[model samples]
Target: MFRWYQRAQVCYVYLSDVSSSVLEGDSPTSLRRKPAIRKSKWFTRGWTLQELIALARVEFFSKEWNSLGDKQSVLLTLHERTGIAVRALEGSPMTIFTIEERMLWAKGRETTREEDAAYSLLDIFDIYMPLIYSKR
Candidate 1:
């Protein structure tokens, strides 16, 4: 998947619930009621980080197959929810952000296996480490 993503000219992202229904008025109370993209299981996955960053051109879609917007239009909202920078989201030529910065994005995210948290980032970081499993 990583290899394919790297070579693909453009990537389309189907954000199943990023529609206007999820976004109400701009009032603080309404904003509080707004659906946060981060809360979605898709955003919480370890592998999704790479998918979000590795692609150069990413198009976002809503649940009803409507186009929410392109990368630029949705970047601020995405960054707010995911804590990833616009630069990284833009897929710069090389990742200028540190590993710690990248890891920060995954802080609240989850994986069924503990090792998957590290394994899913191997390709994104271009590094390898032995995978180990624990009863915890």
Candidate 2:
């Protein structure tokens, strides 16, 4: 899955609980609301951390699939909310960041399976480990 996302041209991030509500204001940015994007559940999943950093291009959509923005457009919001540097979010070489910093990204994320928290990081660290799955 990591390889697939890495080679893909662009990834679409769907915010199921978010909406592009229009709010009137004087500034030019007074078009689509930004608060909801910050509150999305997508950022809480452990798997999403690797998925987000691995991709070069990521397009965001609202609940109804409306064009919310792309990675470049919403870069600041993503950085502020995730505490991830812009360079990482921009798909820089993973080696640029220390292993400790990388690990911090997953510190508070939640994963369903016990092994999956570690599994999802294989791609992030460029470590290849065959997944051995068996029925419980």
Candidate with the greatest TM-score versus the true structure: 2
lDDT of 1 by residue, 1-136 (tens): 5666878887777767556456545655334322544455567777777777777667766666665565666577668778888788877643587878877887877788877877777766777566677786
**lDDT (C-alpha) at residue 24 in model 2:** 32
User: What ranges in model 1 sit over 4 Å off?
Assistant: 18-41, 93-95, 112-114, 129-136
Query: Could you tell me the C-alpha RMSD of candidate 2 in Å?
Result: 2.2
For residues 1-46, could you state the per-residue lDDT of candidate 2 as single tens digits?
Answer: 6787889999899998886653235645423446668888889888
**Lowest lDDT 10-mer window, candidate 1?**
29-38
The ten-residue window of minimal lDDT in model 2 covers 22-31
TM-score of every prediction relative to native: 0.69, 0.86
**Model 2 alpha-carbon drift over 4 Å, by segment:** 22-32
User: What would the TM-score be for candidate 1 when compared with the true structure?
Assistant: 0.69
- Model 1: which residue pairs collide? none
